[model samples]
Target: METVINLFMEKLRNNKGVGLFYFSGHGVQHEGENYLIPVGASRVLRAADQLRYKAVAAGFVLASMKAAGNEVNLIILDACRNAPFKSGFKGDMIPPGLTTMPTVPGALIAYAASPGGVAMNGSGRNSPYVKHLIAWMEKPQLSLNDILRNVRRAVHKETNGIQSPGYYDELNEAFYFNQQVAVNDLAEQQRLAKEKEKLQRQQAELQAERDRLAGEKKAIKKEKARLQAEKERLARQRERDSTPITPTGSKKVFRDRLKDGSLGPEMIRIKGGSFRMGDIQGGGDSDEKPVHSVSVARFAMGRYEVTVGEFRQFVNATGYKTDAEKKGSCYTWVGGNSGKNWRNLGFSQTNTHPVVCVSWNDATAYAKWLSQQTGHTYRLPTEAQWEYAARAGTTTSRYWGNDPNDACRYANVHDNTSKQKNQGFSWTHHNCTDGYAQTAPVGRFKPNAFDLFDMLGNVWEWTCSKYEDNYNGEENRCAGRKSGSLWALRGGAWYYLPGFVRAASRGRNSHDDRNYYVGLRLARLL
Candidate 1:
């Protein structure tokens, strides 16, 4: 058997074609090595020394084939029969079946049964594995992998999961046993040539469209830069001509009276000024790039984020339902769970805590209702106005400074307290501890430079600007309610990391999507 296999391997040397070798005889494994039994062997040839001289090593066969350097090679072994030397071999000295063989490039080795499994010889002339393999190979247009997979499934099902065929394949190119050819070869070649030409033409058209879009994007960016420059110039002229209102003292604070004689949210006057928007301190996302100067007009912004009590007032007066309440769901830390809403967030929140689980649409509706009740133009702040007020004349990463360790004193970010309470929380947190684990009271932490409470933490505040990849004119103006666009969310939530709690960091969501970390702050034009 060894001499015959060597002679066969010489025929395949440097052939540059597909080669196949199949064996259907007894095989055995000794000391983790596979050997094939030859015909007319001695019945008592069970010792390792005697078998080494008569039996053919399977490794030698594979190594010789690899040296042949064929383009593709396949080896099939249906030799995992019951052990014939049970009397001579010790108990469990040799395993039931063959060991796994190492695979080489451009080769596939198939076994009739899985490693350490015994193959069953059917009552017919051949085994069940060989029967399925022959049947599948005769079918045209079936790749080699597909044929083997079908054989494995059929044999496993037929034997009730007792026997399973397996293969180790490293074939670089697709291979089919019986490939089909077109009847009219010349006509088929002409049709394929036409199809290729059409495909090339379509690709050319796509490239042209992409180029046109690129040009339009460049032009839009240029127009945005021109408008921003004009805005800054106009703002400087207005500042020189008119007296600026001092943003300090109690005179800048005011509250509107509702029809029921109740005072509305406390509003702080933000003095008009020009500031460079977007990530200035580095280590930010691409969406915060291409920072530009934006001049904000004087506006009154809420001193604190809208609390649950304030939102409840609006809902009671108008009998309104929030988006989360209407949809009967809200996205939380564990994901969107049914029966979770602003009222029942699976965590305790007092009336003083910031209102969460509110969508952009819900925030806008609340603002409109507040305006009707107080007779004032109240809405969500623009992205530019929110960043400018949050920064308050400083250019550091955070309003307090670049040090994140100082976060616990000024903001309720993810801290040691929350991490200790929730064992599953594995995110990076501030080393210091904030007293509360969940949403802290609106004014529990220190305020920013503008005297705004919870400007960078507790809960993210909704803005009226439509989200864009870069700073366009939309960041400076409020987006219309009817536009189907994602609204921006500024600040960071209590569960957010320190990197996201910066003035330049931005988050966005769809108009109707509600999240537990999002809330709102009112802004009024003066």
Candidate 2:
């Protein structure tokens, strides 16, 4: 796989556009860190073997789709299948499934389930996930994320709560398998295609006219050249002599950080589904243990994390202030003198900036407001859901790797000195960087393989689970159970080191405990 990824590097060139890759298989998490098991597994997969296996890290996915380089690169992972062999992996039952070539911009990646969650075994000859995914690939209506949502729900019902699906992506341009080819109406697409053909014919006629006039006497030639040019010019009209232009709003909108680095608005589709859910590892928390199945019906979920613009829409509609804005708190260096208040951050932020410094209440408020605005259910991703997405289709510890240094690329964490000092990793300041000084704009960095952003670090996102002390009483929690409901938070923030960002890193706080580093992203059923 390492050699294959390297080969992709050779083919990838600036200006060529996007790239994409998809993968599926076993993922392991320990002490809150995640790791994707590779093809040649050792008796037990460990942090050390990861370096040897050369497993794909989340950072590698980001660097490959560098927005500045080849347009955009996207990746999809269908991992998250429940597999045997956890603590000391010794397995015949476990199998590393499929993976694909790396993809660049003008690409799309889709996942079978959320990261860290398992996919259901197909009840039919083909697994439910596989059958539905195959169907999605054959059609053109569903965008990458849209079809996966269908597959996600199908497998959930097929397994009855044994697994959930997820994915990640970083695309510079939109590349749907089949977007409304020229807007939905068949007449519209045909009209556009005809217009393009007419322009080509006219351009050819004008070229011929110029050629015909070029042989005339010198003075006549000059005079005739002007005439011919005018005639040729009209011949290339793209609008078609009888057509009217489509209204501005009627045109399909496209958003991207294109070859020239432009940003624009893009429409999003919501996906929803039901699935079986639970951990294969024996240590599943009470809520995750016993691994019964669930039947999450279909619903919509955003394809990517909510942008600052999207969140602002909610704030504008509700006139609601997040906990941080209300409390006048700012993100502070864990030990910095400025850690006193939000005003200390020293900058006026905008609506397009991700709303940071939130508590669970703030996150939930935003979700509620969004639900009201869009008339759909919206809320923080559950712990299982968040992991499934964060993993995209991977199960690697930390998404990227065990190395803390590599995290700087995908997340704004303590890898650099100033950030480390602020969020608390002061001891390793040798290679620290205070680059942005504050949060860079959302999506400023690259995305994970699934096209999801900030899954590893940036802000610690709130989840829908209550934190528990241990995984000791597992069985009771798995059977349609409800334990502590204070809600747990997953994914590390800029305040912590990369190690803490590992999927296994867990934290608990009251619903009202707001901080400069807390924020939220939402998910829904399909």
Candidate 3:
């Protein structure tokens, strides 16, 4: 299976066309992880560690395919056979069949059965799935997704109540197995060309108008800031005058109102206080210069990065599509390409793993939905708030300390796993073994002083703050500011080095740019 996967990757890399990977074997889901079993692999059933090492991870295969740069990739798994070694393993270790595979960018993973359901092995040579797939695949002008739907319908009918096929399609462009281009009528083509030209002209005019408005807005903002500073000065004086007297050593913690685990995240109370919110030691970016004091109010923040399962529930309930999903592409480590989206993050993520490939807009949308559902205003943490929470009353590079050796114990940084995966690139991993090449499941490592898990790694988290050249008057806003320019993301990801994964470190991306390494966690007002 590994050799076959290698061959597929080689072919995909060498060609600029579509690629297909069809597997017919035993597949199983073991504790939410999907595996493709090769011939005679059941012998290692009792040795759990050996079995994992021997079997081909579906995630690994998909990751390779994603990196291969294929125009389109199709994966057919008619391998959802029943758990052959169920008796030897623990009851929960093996599910009835393969678990659901998430959508992959520029690829489709079609299963013979719905996740956790058994696939039928026909008495004849080929299974019902294979038979229908072959027939539908040969149909002229039918798209791959369309053909799969037809195949799914046929397989369901043939198996009766025994089986139902499922698919995760991430294709952004139409692909026909048998290419047939229709001739265009001359008159209709001319009319369409004129319409296109008109639309282009209108778009150009609209862009000019936007540019003019933006210039005017910038000028007005400068004037507003001048007056706003004086207004804020008086407001601050008023705020100071009305301050309630409290004991010097006083502390407070605010917990979430909803603890049912269905409506919102499990939050940890952050007892806000005055903290110097930037890189004090000259070891960080220029943006982190002139370490300034910031005062914050008490609030609650997610204990861990929002997981894939949590986001799935939001999507299912609200029918909300992520920006990447709507735009049909997102940035990956390799670069931007069509078909990459939040659903297909170029790597596999279990329910507990952090959700990635989400834009700032998508994060805000999720926050809005969560707020509406829970009746608590959920929003992204402010840059200052995130720094305050992550610091946990500490001023070190991380909440723990400045030692890179301690990284894997508390957070997942670019480690031995990532170095091994990309030998050609120079990796400044902490040299610790975090046991994950990509994003790890949330809370895999120890929590910080605030009891917040994954505040520094697994994925860069979106904050409500918009990016500024340097901190100026923006620090006063507790909820952070939003701008048309780039937005801020705090924390570093599993792929970044320990240097970038600091409590005071800052990263920014365009508001609309979604990448596999970026995710979000919400903050709720106390």
Candidate 4:
């Protein structure tokens, strides 16, 4: 099979003439992929995995033919028999029949039957589909598309709708077979046929043009909506700025710790102030577009991220099962399904380490449980609140300054320790080392001006705000979920690059998608 594929590829690349390929054998379609069984291949297919080694993928064959530089190519498969290996398969039980191929320039793929229907191999010298196809090709001056349509009609009439042929064609130039005698008669027939095809193609082109214009109109409408959202956000910011400063309506600024019982993490009071939110550098993503003013009221935020010990306390009290624990899988930095979770993160972490692999929903549940236990309103911080705290009254890219060389002193990120431990494998890392490869113990790094630790790098902290493409005025408030929307994430993780640690950077994920680089930070009203 390999040799045959190689030879066919060679013909396609070197031969300038038309290439016609015909296959007549058993075939199967699984999960939208069609595979052709070679004559000498295995007959017993118990699972989709075994088929990979025993059959040639039709998509690969078509791709090779496309790159072969042939003026035109035709691939006909008469092997849509739905028998021989129809048992013992689990999951995505092989689709009933061969699927349709995508349209490619200068190429046509014709099947013996419509997609997902069994083609009758007719107990004779040839199948009805192939017999009619041969007869139609012999007829003079019939374009390939016309010939296929005629064959499809004849087969449908003969089989009474039990079997119908189908094809995907993108042929621009017309070519006909068996063109001899009565040259003028043949020329006139070809002219009329070509004219009809020209009109049909023009109609299709016109429809395509209309679709393109409609898409442009939709894009314009979206832009208008985004601009309106921006204007409203700016207006709200102006209103906030003109208003007097207050801490939850209290005139006095609260700078001390606020706590109830041992149910929730300790919170530090942040003074009420106004600052320019979003990316001030003008180098951020579209989501951070049109950097605008924002005013935040005083709120108590966790001094450090929720720790393993704290999360354990929540679970011990509530007997709650995390989404990852329930599903038995979590996404890790290496990739998904690395067998890592909050309990076992493939790294050494004491009770002091921030909890990882907790989904947004799990974090929200934890906050709710804490609120119930402490008799206070506890929830994930809003996106505005997170950025305000992370900035710590600074206007630079980071709370410290624009320079990233001083990052190791502020937070633990992908650094020299990670490079040496992972055999120099790093997506983006800093030159300095933070003494930890994965996650560091909570409060290991120095706190910002507001006494917030690990505010930029550690594990991403979940926010209560649902994610938006840009910061609309609505997102400035504690926005709720919109149907199936992903929740917003803030701060960068140890495995991320220095750029992602910027104060304005944002991330998001499904509410139930737990990951090793995602965790929780508690927040509550003052």
Candidate 5:
């Protein structure tokens, strides 16, 4: 079953379309973590012995596909053969329930029987659950909810009420698998939305300061607050894009909104100045040396980092294929295994998880896609721009502090103290697991002096400068990507020791290297 899933996952890495998984066997649940009893699945989910298959089951799968971590996700689970290993659950384990479980955002889990009941098996080779699932999936134009209802009825009738299949057990909303809504629909929806009234008001209040600089009239706190009304107007101005219009409407008109500013947000102002680009701290790598102060131009950045929801918008608009999406595999660091890909990896994330496994090219493509969609010049932040925004105006080596363990608290660093050692005594966390033990929520931890989060630890951020082993102390006087050397990476990752996280710490990896730790932030030239 693991092999089968691995094969399917190989396919899942790229295609953002509908996905269907049919587990044809037993299932179990302990302590809210569900388990799919793979062929001869044993009581333990330990990987030490592959003697029998054990997995975090339909529960884990359902949660993953729903990763809508900014993209929409849908899942269907057909296994409910029998709760074979129910008795073997160890301490702190909760029995599986079919009817209901706590809700996961952007996720819906289904079962073959009502919560806490056994699933019915067929007298023939196939399980009663599988028959209904296969039949229902073949139905046309059936809303996901209606199909589930139909499946529950059929399974119940076949089992003579013995197996009452549960779907959206807690009544979680079903995302219609057949009528897939692509990015364009969602963007248009946002286009007509007057919802960002509050957010607009907030940005508007900051505008006076946004319009201010040295030698300018200082914005009084009250004046900034007074601009909330103006925000309502901008919300209305922005709201024109969301109204659902006919698909036959002129493409050029709609294209104009996206390009000109259909659904654009205000830019985050970054103060331009000089700062040491590479790590000057001793524990950092040699590549981090030749610390040089380079003057950066001021620019406005996306107030929030690009989000999964936003990325999905870009894909829907252009039908763009990401590198990983095209490759049919995504590089992920596997626990207990040295290498892994998208199929085995699960995507349980809030809308906030930092986009991971994306390449420098992929990041750039997204920025480019956004520019085309909304007619904005969004691109990966230059090395200088990223630091300015990340610092939010703190002079410390780390935005939070020099402590790397503290990184675990605020960002998703080496928080797996049980697997690794826990050194951070006082720290922050994104309030959730980093999923891959690699990437965490974008906003995890408190923001820096500038209100930016996860700048020092979590994932390695990409920069624009070409890699140079020895740069002149005057970085402004440096040359572009030296021969053989690639671009630089900053901050550290969960897998790295603390030494790599210093603000000035510098290191370089190949442009072709796609690992779990690499991700990038974007900035636009004013």
Candidate 6:
């Protein structure tokens, strides 16, 4: 089964057009994870782990499709018949029916029965779900969504609500099973015209709502500015009340003045410290091996990931184009989408959201521009410094703790909210919801022990150190930004799974690679 999936994935990678995968067999759920059972698999069901090893993991199939990066992919599973291992499995160890899986970008997965519900093996030749699916699929010009909706309705009626078809869709564009249009039919043409007119009306309504939201956003920004001014005034007053001190004894939080006299990003003072670097916790990757002690000098680091508003100010002042803008695209879940940059992400973003789609070079340039504006030494943190700050005196997988379930309180990661919004794509997400599907406003969640926001998730932060397979002296110092060097990226992004959101997890990309999942934070010599 794995070999078959691999071959299908390879074919999908080679094909630029649409791809479709359909399976008809027995499927089961083990501990909330779905699996498809191949023929003669009942012999290997002595243990739960054995079944896991033998059965085809539905997640692996979904992930392979995502990795293939096809434009449109469809998966139909008529495998929700009664469990094949009911005699061998005990209790809920092997559930009665298959579990639901998320859809990847530009893909959809349809099931013969609603998630966690059983389906009849069919008294007739075909199950009710498959029968309706076939009937609806043959209809011309019916979209996949429409066909599935019809199938669900028909199956519910046929089974008297005992079974209903289900689907997870993450497609950005409509896909029709039959592309033929009834152009000669006058009634069909009039119906199409009316549909187009209705779509235009909806678009107009959306534009009006967007305009209203824009006005509200402007008002909120003004209010936020007023509040920030008040906070700054209080901070200044407190500074004046205390004795002036050197960088080594500076206050916990401080901000520098920009060239326009506006305050820059809030900086948190990190005291000099020595600690073990690399994956202290077990289950980390090989790159995070060889844990060694490293000492960092006293410095100030950004309290939050750099915001869209902050990056915009630099762009406005310098008229600097980001690497994404220059390259004409940024990598997204769907692949490199043309014209998708920081200013024009496919989704909506407020000014407070952390700026993404900026490459390592762009990040470094922003740091340089900031240093010029503030007359302070600003740069990306060394790999060790970032890990140290992120760890914040913790030895756990994350500063919050080992359990990924508690992630919603500490950081914005792939969670229940994301699963609900991006119903396409399968991943093990945090058990909780952080009230955001994508990037949340910086500092929305609770900060770590070091009072740093989004150190683990929101967007991957670039470091000044080059990536190496194993720990060397490079982790402690900045590597020269020579071409073809792979710079290290710390933290994770909104779309990251539980394993990738750990403090010790490391990622690397070329300096010029711009992605929607990457951003930056700056550190300064205090």
Question: Which lDDT tens digits does candidate 1 get at residues 1-526?
Answer: 8888888788898466677988877777877788777876634453555667788878888888888889788999888764444211311234556888897999999999998676777644467899999989988899999999999999999778878999999999888998977557888899988997999899899978987887898789667745754664465456446734435468768889999999899899999999989989888766787888999999999998999999999988999998888989886643225778889898888889999999899999999998999888999999999999999898998898998867777788877667656533545677665656778989766677777888887888999999887887889988886656777889977877676788898887778877777899999989
lDDT of 5 by residue, 1-526 (tens): 5566555555565666444555545555544445666554453432222322446455556545544232434455554433422112210122433335555554445677777665655644456777777678766667667878898898889877767877653333445556634546777768655566767778888865556642243456335533642553355345445534334453211222465355653345566777666564455445556566667787665544455556666667778765666665554423311233222344344546556666566676776676666556776665556666666655666776766644544555654331323211112332222323555667644555544556677677766666556665322322243445466666666555455555665555555445555666666666
- Against the true structure, what is each candidate's TM-score? 0.54, 0.41, 0.51, 0.55, 0.44, 0.58
Clashes of each: 0, 81, 0, 1, 25, 3
Give the alpha carbon lDDT tens digit for every residue of 260-363 in model 2: 34332232232233333344333323333444433333323333445566666556667877666666554343322234333334444555555565667767
Candidate 3 residues lying further than 4 Å off, grouped into runs, are: 1-261, 334-336, 476-483
Residue 515 shift from truth in candidate 1, angstroms: 0.8
Candidate 4 clashing pairs?
12-68
Clashes of 1: 0
C-alpha displacement of 273 in model 6, angstroms? 1.0
lDDT against the true structure, per candidate, is 0.81, 0.51, 0.75, 0.76, 0.54, 0.81
lDDT, candidate 4, 1-526, per-residue tens: 7578779889768767787888887788876778888875633443578777778888877887887878788899886765343111311135556888685898889999888766776634578888898989988877888999999999999888878889888876876776655646878989988997999899899989988887898799667755754664565467457745435544332223225334346678788789998889766656776688889898888889999998988788778888888888775534225466788766677889999989888998988887777668889998888999999999998887887757777888877666556521324577665667788999866667887889988898999887777777745666565668777788887877676778888777767877777898988897
RMSD of 5: 24.0
Q: What global local distance difference test value does model 4 have?
A: 0.76
Q: Choose 1 or 6, whichever is better by lDDT.
A: 6
State residue 117's C-alpha deviation in candidate 5, in Å. Answer: 39
lDDT of 6 by residue, 1-526 (tens): 8998888889889886687878888777777688787888854454456667888888888887777888888888887754533122411124456788767778899888887677765544577888788889988888999999998998899877878889999998999978885599899899999998999899999989988887898789667755754664565456456734335444798999988899999999999999888888887777888988999998989999999999999999999998888989886543226888999888888899999999998999999999999999999999999999999999899998999977876788888678667633334678766767888999876678888999998999999999887898888889887876788889977887787788888888788887777899999998
Among the numbered candidates, top lDDT falls to: 6
Candidate 2 local accuracy as lDDT? Answer: 0.51
lDDT of residue 192 for candidate 6: 93
Number of the top TM-score candidate = 6
Give candidate 2 misplaced runs (Cα > 4 Å): 1-309, 325-331, 334-348, 417-425, 429-434, 471-485
lDDT of 3 at 159: 80
User: What is residue 522's positional error in candidate 3, in angstroms?
Assistant: 0.6
Sort the predicted structures by lDDT, highest score first: 6, 1, 4, 3, 5, 2
Higher TM-score: candidate 2 or 6? Answer: 6
